[model samples]
Target: MNTRSTSTFGHVALIVAHCAGMVDLVALPVWVGTLIQHYRLDPQQAGGLVTLFLIGAVLSSVFLASRFQRVKGRWVAAGGYAIAATCFGVLSQPLDVTTMAVLHAAGGLAAGAALSATHGTIARSANPHLKFAIVGVGLGVFAVLFLGTSPKAIAAAGGYMLFAIFGGVMLLAALVCAIGFPDPEREATDRQGAPVAAIPRAVWFGILGISAMALVQSMTFSFLERVGNDRGFSLNAITGVLVVLGFVNLLPAALAAFFEKRWSARSVLMVGPVLQALLAATIMMAPGFYAYAAAASVFAAVMIFTHTFAFGLMARLEPSGRAMAATPAMLMVGAAIGPVLGGTLVKTAGYGSLGLAALLIGSLAVLCMSRLPGHAPSSLAQEPA
Candidate 1:
């Protein structure tokens, strides 16, 4: 096939892989809830399943993507999905809680590899500035759908059957990836395969900004549904909020890509934290479904903006697509860490702690953004990576 043909196929496969990730992520809370009930486990024991999944993701980013250079992107993603599906199927079987936890861990390990490979694919195929938002939108779209809709279906049909359906989805997604996605970089580019380093000192602050933005945004996402429920919001209202927020999340990304020609990446990232803090504070004070939904929309937009900018900077710092792509891995680590910290804060201080924590994290990010070195102005939507 021609270059355009190859790029098209690659893009399609990458998007498919991203969509599959959303399916897996959305299905998790349901599965975890089932495990807790089925095994008569404590919250801590059930929580360990999520922890293992995240740990697997973090480890894959740091260890698998960072060090391994020989593996092809297509196979890594497909293989991981296959493994995850197989594990989930086994987990659905009648088993002890300990056995189920082991299966969950194995699935998580596969998901880690799948996650990194998907990032590498998207980074290689698209421009850096748009990578996160584009991927975020794809993820948010299906996530909103599944997380928003699937729980009721599972409740009506039977929870165990959901795992089988999810496993089938994984198999379909993996097959699509294996057959369609090409190598991340053409074979000839091996010597220069997206070389990246720890982001440069000049951009350290920008990195911090993105990380902080992710922390706050993730905290909101983790708890907002519960908060909405507490506020007596109906299921439809909750679903509306998620759908709206998902749509809102794409706006900043689309705007950033459209204006990257005019705006410095630093300038774009610098706008996220304050927006997040204001919205978070508003939610704390108002706590209505409408107010909370509006807050979520704006927060998602700003977070997308900050993420795209910082990822763009990372790509600029590491021209090697592969190396620059690892920024997602790093962000994944921060994301994994944020929820645990947030849970602790909420447990000790009550739900109101979410507002305070958001303020702190957002403030730290703003401070970091203020100190980042400026890049030369350019119209190029894609960063060097």
Candidate 2:
């Protein structure tokens, strides 16, 4: 294919891969709820299952990210999703908790590898921020469809259907990526025999900042449905809130794209965690249904918006794409801690403790953001690879 045609196809593949691989963002509520309601697990156990999945993702991403240039992105993206599909399919079968936990971890490993390939390719694109935002928009649309339909499907056919749906989506992504995942142009350091420059310290801070925000996001989001349910909201009402949340999700990435130049990325990064903490606090502590629903709906937007900027910044900081290749590690490391931590807080201290936790974590995120340099250093920019 011509370069233009190849780039177009790759973009589409990335979008699909993102939606499939980040299914946790949309499915966590139903996922945790199903384990609690159907499998009769407590909140802590349900959250622990999700935590195992994220921990596996973190491990896989960290391992593969460093090898990004050596490995073939297309093969990794396709094979990972293919394996993840099988794992999810097997998870649909009736199994003991131990078996199910193992499957979740395995599936997460596969999915995380695929996502590492996806983000690495995007980082090498002409405009990483714009490309990432475009993919984020695609994820938002997928979230709308998944959130709107999956709950009802699970209700009708049992919780097993949720895993079936997840398997199907991963299978489809695998097929598309196999056909069209584009090869990124190698950096000069790779083309020659020279070593790539080390990732900047600022980039590490950006990654940590984004991860902290993600921790707050998953910690609160994983329990969104249960919080409402415990507060006596009807199933339809909570589902409706989720659907609205998906729609709200549609705007943040686009807005981030528009503001990429107009707004300071560092400022956005700092403000994001504060907004997230406030929203989470409201979601956790609000007594009225409307108040809780309002906060829950906009919560994801904060992470999406901030992460878009952070992704772009890291791409600039490390032109070789290794930093961005660790996208799954940056995202899932903190995410790995969130569900279990949230569950522990809830199990011991009630939902109000989640609000307190968000405040503390958000403050840490802000501190990390504060440590970032205002821009990528000139020496790093001029350095080969």
RMSD of each predicted structure: 4.0, 2.5
Model 1, residue 105: C-alpha shift (Å): 3.2
Question: Can you write out model 2's per-residue Cα lDDT over 85-199, one digit (the tens) per residue?
Answer: 9999999999999999999999999999999999988887656788889999999999899889988889889989989999999999999999998877445356567778888
Number of clashing residue pairs in every model? Answer: 4, 0
How many pairs of residues in model 1 come into backbone collision?
Answer: 4
Off by over 4 Å in 1: 1-6, 22-48, 93-97, 130-134, 158-169, 185-199, 203-205, 376-385
The alpha-carbon deviation from the true structure for residue 295 of candidate 2, after best TM-score superposition, in angstroms, is 0.5
Give the poorly placed runs of model 2, Cα more than 4 Å off.
1-6, 185-188, 377-385
- Where does candidate 1 clash, by residue pair? 194-320, 194-321, 194-322, 195-320
Predicted structure with the largest TM-score when compared to the true one: 2
